[model samples]
Target: MDRTFTEHLLQWYDANRRDLPWRSNPEPYGVWISEIMAQQTQMERVVAYWRRWMERYPDLGSLAAASEEEVLKVWEGLGYYSRAKNIRKAAELILTDHAGVFPDEIKQIQALPGIGAYTAGAIASIAFNKVAPAVDANVLRVFARLLDIAEPVKAAKVKQEVEQAVLPLIPEKRPGDFNQALMEFGAMICSKRPDCDQCPMSQHCAAFANGTTGERPVLPRKRKAIHIEMATGVLVYNDKVLIQKRKPDDVWPGLWEFPGGCVEKGETPREALVREYMEEVELEIYPAEKITVVSYSYTKYRVTMHCYLCHSANNGQLKPVFNEAVTGQFVSPESLSSYAFPAGHRRLIECMLDEAWFDNLK
Candidate 1:
C-alpha cells in the first residue's frame, strides 16, 4: 500500500464529506446509537430515527432506565428487533457495570451485548480517536478493490487480511477521520457499482489499474430462499385485536404480531389458523372472511402470510397460555401505535384501517 493514496483519500474526504447528523455531534453514546442503527440500513433512512432517538434518550442513563417495550417502540420499523433489545441490555450494563459511562476501551465496548468488532472499532476510532479499524461491508469493498483481492470478501481469512492491511494505514493524529474517509469512500465512490471515474484514489486502486474494479471483491454464492406459508388470525372483540408477543428466542422477539403459525403440509390456511389459535392461545376462534395475504422476506426465508378476520367462538374470553417471557393481550386499534410490530403486521394494521374495522371504535 502506498502513502499517497491515503493522502489523496483524506483530502477528498475533507472536501466532500456528507453532513450527517451524527457528525454534527459525535458524542460517544450518540455515535454508538448511530452505528448500531446504520447497520444493514441506509444512512438517509437512519437519520430521522437517530434524531428522534437522541431526543427521547439523551444519554446512557436515560437509555439504561428505559424498558425493553419502550425501546422497541421507538425502533419499531427498523427491522432487526434484536438490535434494539441488545442496545437496551448494553445500556443497562453500562450503567451498572461502568457507572453509566460509555467505555472508551475497544474490548470493553465489544463486551456490550450487540457491539461486535466493527461497531466497537467504529465507536473507538470515531468518538474516542483511538487507532482502530472498523471493517464493515463498505470498508471491505473499498479495500478489496484497492488491493485487487480476489478472495470472497465474506470469508474470515479475507476479512482478517483486510483488517491487517488497514491497521498500518491508521494515522495516529487522525485515525477517526481516516477510518471514516475509507468508509465514506466506499459508500460514495467504490460501492458495488463503483464510480471509478470520480474516485480520487483511482490511480492507486489495483483493480482499476487492472481493469477489474467490478470483479475484485468476490463474494460467496448465496443460498436459495426457503419458502414458507403461514396462517394468521386477526381476532377482534369490542374493537380490540388480540396480538401475541413473540418469544425471546423467536425471530423478531419483543415485537407483537397477529396470532398464528406456519401452515402444516396438508392443512389449509384457515384450518391452520384455527389450530394455531387453539394451541397457542387456548381459544377457539371461528375464522371468517379472509382479510389479506402478506408477503415478506427475511435473510434466509420468504414468507407468505394468510390473515383472516376471526371472532371468538361463543364470544368466549381468551385463556391465553402465558409464560414469564411471552404473553398475549387484547388492545384497541388505536393503542397499536404504542407497541412495535413487525412490518407484515404493520401492513396488516393499514389494511384494517382501510376496511374501517376501527373507525367506529375511534
Candidate 2:
C-alpha cells in the first residue's frame, strides 16, 4: 500500500471532482446506477439519464415492482440492454434475499447480477465506507502511466494486477474519496491525450518523466464498423397500423417493429424492402410516402432504417415475412398498448401518431 500515492491523489480530488448529483450522498443505489450508466456511454449523456432514472425508480423496491417492458422503455436508447436486465434482476434479488437493503460486504455485493469486482469495490468503499479497491478503465489508465506498464490494460487477466497494486495504496480514513480521486485524476489529467503540464502527479508520473505519456498501457484496437441498410414499411390502411413480431431467433427477438429487410451492397432500401417482402411474406407492396429515416446501434453493428408508408396496390394478401417472423397483422392505435415494440419502432410510431399537427408545428 503506497500511502503517499493515495494521499496525493485524494488531495487533488478535494478541489477538482466534477459536480455530479450522485456524489452528494455516496448512496449504494445511486453509485450503482451511475456506474452502470457510465458503461460504453459518455459521462455527459449518462448524467441526464441518471438523474431521470433515479427520479423514476428511487430504490430496489420500486424497481422490482415495475414491469419488464416499462423498465426497458425507461432504459431505451442507452444500448447494452443486458445492463438494464441485470439491474432488474438485482433489484428482485435484493427484495427476496436482502430484504430491500443493498448488501454492503464485498462478496455479497459482487454476487449481485450486474455487480463485478470494480462495482463491488465501488459500492463498498463509497457507500459502506470500506477500504475496497475500485479499479476501472480510468484507474487502470492512471496506474498504467504511473507505473510505466506498457501491456495492454484491457487484457481480462490484468484486472487482478491493477486491483492488487491499488489495494495497498487506499487511504484508511477516506478510501471512497481516494478511489474517486484516482478515477478523476485519470479522467482529467492522465487521459488518452493527457495534459502533463497541469497534472499534480506529473512530477512523480513515470510515463511523463520518460516522455512516454502517450505510449504506455496500449489499448486494443476497436472493431470494424458494421454497415447495414434496412427498409421499414409504415403500412397504414384506414386509421390502423401494420407491425410484425420478431421471432426468438431474430436479432431483435420479441420486439414489435415495422416490416423491413437489410439491403445488399448494390440494392437500395426500397428495393431491399420489396425483395424481402416477397421472400419473407409472399406479399407485394406499392410504395406511397417515404415517411422518415432513423438509426440505431447494436453491439456489433449499426442500422440505418428507411421507413416508407406503403399501401397494397390491390389490397393484396399478407403472409409471414421470412421464417423469423410468423405474424404480420394490422393493429388499432389502441392495440399498441399490448405490444412491446423496439425503441426505434416506438419512436416512429409516436411520430406517425403525431403527423397531423407535426407539419403545422414545424
Judging by lDDT against the true structure, name the best candidate: 1
lDDT score for candidate 2 against the true structure: 0.79
Clashes (N, CA, C under 3 Å) per candidate: 0, 4
Runs of candidate 2 exceeding 4 Å displacement? 245-255, 278-283, 313-362
Candidate 1, TM-score vs. the true structure?
0.95
**Shift in Å, residue 197, candidate 2:** 1.4
- How well is each residue in 1-362 modelled by candidate 2, as lDDT tens digits? 35776677777889889998899987999999998888878889899999889999998888999886677767776766668878999999998999889998999999999889888998899888899999989989987888787788888667778888888888778888888888778778787888788888777788888888788777889898897778888666665667777775666555667777888888888888887767665667766777788787777678888888776654544444454485768787767766767767777777766775123210
C-alpha lDDT of all candidate models, in order: 0.88, 0.79
Clash tally for model 2 = 4
